[model samples]
Target chain A: MRGLFKKRRLLMVVTALSMLVLAACGNSNNNSNPSASPSESSAAPATETASASASESAPIEKITLKALMHSSWLKGGMEAVLKDAVEKTGITLEIEKLPEGTDGDNLIKTRFATNDKPDLLFFYPAVKESDGLGKPEEQFVPQDDQPWMANFNKDVWIDAFASSGTFYAAPYGGSSMAVMIYNKKVFESLNLQIPTTMEEFWALSEAVSKAGKVPVYLSAKDAWTLQIPSLQSGAAQDNLQEITDNAYTNKGTMSDFTAKRQGITFLKDVVDKGYVNKDFLSDTYDNAQKALANGDAAMYPMATWVMTDISTKFPDQVNDIGSFLIPFNDTGKNMAGIFPPSAMYVVKGSKQEAAQKFVNYFESIETQNIYFGSEGGIPTIKGITNTQLTSAELDAQKLADEGKAGPVGVSPSSGIPQYVAGDYPAYLQDVVAGAKTPEQVQEAEQKELVKNAKAKDDPNFK
Target chain B: MLKRQYYRYSMLAPGFCIFLVFFVWPAVSNFFYAFTNLDATFKYTRLVGFDNFISIFEDSGSSIAFKNTFIFTVVTTISKVGLGFLLANFVNIKLRSTNFLRSALFFPVILSPIAVALAFTAIFHPSRGFLNVLLQSVHLDFLMQHWLTNRHIIMYSISFVETWKWTGLTVILFLAALQTIPKELTEAAKIDGATSWEQKRHIIFPLILPVVNTNIIISLIGGLKVFDIVYALTGGGPGNASNVINTMVYKSFSQGRNGEATAASLLLFVFILVLVSITNKYLNKDNRG
Candidate 1:
């Protein structure tokens, strides 16, 4: 009986060892497929382009470039552009979608850390350096010599993506500005004009509140939306970049910048005055859009992306939405804060060429029109006019033409810590909850800025 | 004889290899990472000793997470085990629909945590939630509360959801253990002039002490490692009111502070180990007595 048991155990051990070897082989095969396919496909495209030159009539293999995009970006006419690229260039894009916000940002970093980088990825290059990918110069393929780069709008690319005169990313879509989108019907009902100064804005708020409607819909629950009032405050500061730079380099504090400081103060003021929704803490950006569309709220201080979202959801109410720059100061000189579009970056990978080709086709005038038609905004490329521009777009563009607009928000390129921009809304939430005063928020922010700067090994912080 | 012994040990080789690779390797690397300043942005990694741990301890965010985690674990653990026992007893009573009732109770456990949290988000909406509407309709207006938004009650609210989803598991476990109790023993007690409550107190409770102890440990571990529910529901928001250690670790990792995030995770591991160990020791003593 003992020998029979031992024989059975020997047979089981041999079977287990064989199964383990098979599993190992299967895993190794699975691991190589992703990295191998990209290179194999990338090689085909290059040779096809070369062979087509040698023989005029030849078929090109459709190359699929892997890309990582936030799930929200698909709504911004990115899918149309992807389909257009495939139709025109025969280069397919296999996109891996991730959740947006902090969750998405961390996943992108993890991908890079694990050396599982996609051919292309979406990120705002202005703040890309301090983010997980490290310095953009080392991480991305420079697009300085690309034909599309020359046709791109110089001001935006230089201000937003270019660091030390080098471009690493191309704008995926047009620019958006942080502006106050108001319901024209609500304004007409209240008999209020578009406010151009802080005093007039407060007057309009009181008027709307008297009518028993929310004057301003503050979506503090989303947290990121809380930064709009403060970001809009940057419009009135002529030396906004300078002030941010000083704070970035540890030479000045956030409280030293008065205009931006007032933005958080305005959030608290609106809540205290009962001008915002009663459930501001519970309200989300989606809920804010509904309130604005239904004329339950007068104004929502948000980026122009809400226009696309609102118009898509409520087409009839689209015409009733009008926008103006946030009059955050009493001086009546508020410029609309210009926000750069989320750009497509070429990660240093085996499929850079195909990614560049897709970017080129995506920037062409015909494809851009499709993007702007569906998701209306200012085209970042030169000589491409969007005929279907919304009233909000025209108003923001008018501010830009009059030299009243400047860059808004702190970016890593400006020497500020990345988390200051990423987590500022959390502090604003505390401010909204009355857990921290604006001054206290600034003090806490300053301390965080120093700690992060030191972590990054910035000499000035030491 | 030597060859037979070798064959016996070789049977464990594959299983041991998988455990070593998947669990042990990552745990060991995480331990090493906790002692370094390794982050997403840094190209080179260097050791910073206990600075990551010290930083986590000093941060206000970590303190909030620790407090919230404590409340969440305790509330969920007690509620799940206690409610599970009652439900198990109720279902164990010979009924025609016992099998159907068991399936209905376990249904919530199979649903996705994210889906459940999202459905609960709408159900807990301040002005429009079904819970509040039902309360108002029943004329219990004073009992209606902001189920998700109130910072003070957010953890408890989340704990309620956790308990609701997982209590069925405990019920199933306790039910299985209860079935093993011989009918003869309970019948003898009944014949000796004992009431149902008396029989339960003397027979069922003592017999199922082991299951109850197991349920507590399972619930305790599950409560500590919770991430998806809290993340999907609140994202640790309305100003970090519902932040737990895992969510805090996620935020730190999001901010590229991998070292601090790993240190926080290590602390959580140690916390779970100590709590489970103490509970194990106490429960074993009870079982022995």
Candidate 2:
């Protein structure tokens, strides 16, 4: 009986150990799949892209696009478009929704590095060196000669992804990068019109400040908030393209970035003069709209996305909110900054003919109409009218139509590896705090750029 | 002898298979991959030897991150373990509400770190936050601060949240250790005319010294390797102000510098290994003594 008991005990131990081993092996398999999902997202089954495609589209040609998209595109009602495309084209979608912010960027890069290439890349086409998603000759191509290019909004496309005479990706929609949205009621009370030049903007802000209200409400605590006015302020440079070109081509240096500091200086001046909200540093993106709604501030430097947020949050103020250009230059065509919309890219060796066919058909006015009905932002496809639009979106759309919407943010492929384009906002934050002048940030950026160039083996370092 | 050896090997096979597949295989592959000049797409990859490791020191931001990580680990470990020990002693006293107090203290540990960090976000909000609002109501407005934004206080604010979330676990650990001490020992200490402090110092402290050592080692390891709380709270910013080695590893990986990220993670692994080894050595020595 004792010997039998000992053997049974050994069997139990082996059984438990085998279970542990199996569990560990299962967890290792889960590592290949990302578990990034926003709160509202449904938990998807862990299905292999190929297997899923084969099973669903077995009766058809099994055209599955393994897609990677940023969370915003998913949350911003891009599903309407994706579902519509699948229904129209019969091409099944295998989607990977990435986490918000730089986490998604890392995941996409990791997927690429691991040779796990998705067929369709639906991401915001950022040209910043760090946001190396849709760089020239990387995973995607220009595909400029495609017939679908004719339908894309020409002005916004040129501003957003086009650099070095190579278009980066297809922009689904675009907006004036820095639309200075304001409470028209406050403007009316102060007898202020939309400022169209540098002098007018400053004077208007000063007048609003004298009226015992915050002239501007910068949600600086949300660091991404500062990029709005800063990027638009760079539009003051008449030769902005030349400077950007020189920077990437190794001919530009820190000296050329001097003009880009004007907005930062302007912001510092406002903050120092007590014209900005005292609680601006603590005011979150969530509360900024509420503040504007309750008349806590007059103007905020925001994008059409903010405009969308405001209308969504406070539906009563849809008509009350108005937007204008950043007006960094008195004479430079009110240079509008347009952000690249979340766009799709076809993998190089993907079933190109089928992919091209799907992409081409998705661009048709009928498909875009169904897409635009649910989606906001300026329509990328020509002739898709944006209904229930705010004055801000309308103004931005007008700029897009006029070919005045300029590019915004650090060029993604500016090749100067050291100086982070995103760090410009941090410098702006310090500038407002009166800790460092814009020149100091520029100096640090210069040193870093030189180091980066040397490190990258760029010939421009000397 | 051969059959007995075969039986022994068979008994070991399951756990070895797990460690071999899950741990050894990936670790070996990762170690090999660390040397490669792996591009964004892995298309044109080659071995680049120690270049990835060299760049670890080459970047200035790396030093700041390492320093912040070290400081955060030390400060939070001390705060959690010290506070946890004090709370454990107080709760161990003969009182009616000691059970309730113990449960209340351990509540935060049971809650998710992300949830705790989110709650701290509201608590630390400079103007409208609970901390500042409470301060203002109490006429202590000067005590209010930009908790997560100001680079100076960002790490402490994050560490405070870290300590708050995990201190309960340490308290519970210490409490369990304290319960093991015989009541007669304390009664004898009291009869000998030993003061409360003296009783605690000589009798209680020495009796729970092993548990104390264990708690310290646990706290140290937990503090050094913390990620979710810091990631959720400050994200190592206002501008890399509260950055740790892990956040830097994340950023490097994001930028498609996989080789550099692997090196950064390896550096963290080495730091953890050294600290844990020292802790183990101390604990083993104490047990023997």
Count of residue pairs whose backbone atoms collide, per candidate: 0, 4
Give a tens-digit lDDT track for model 2, residues A78-189: 5676676666555777788888666777787767555456656776653433354434466565557777778876664565655444564666543435677888899998
TM-score of each: 0.93, 0.83
Write one digit per residue (lDDT tens) for candidate 2, span B1-289: 7866776787778778878988999888667767764434432246767877777787666887888888888888899989999999999887999889988999998898889988998888887789999999999989989888787788888888888888898899889988999999989989999999999888888888887787788877787777788888866666567778888887666545666677777778788899889878977797667
- What TM-score against the true chain A does chain A of each candidate get? 0.90, 0.77
Clashing pairs in 1: none
- lDDT for position B9 in model 1: 73
Best by TM-score: 1
TM-score of model 1 (first chain only): 0.90
Model 1: residue B269 alpha-carbon error in angstroms = 0.9
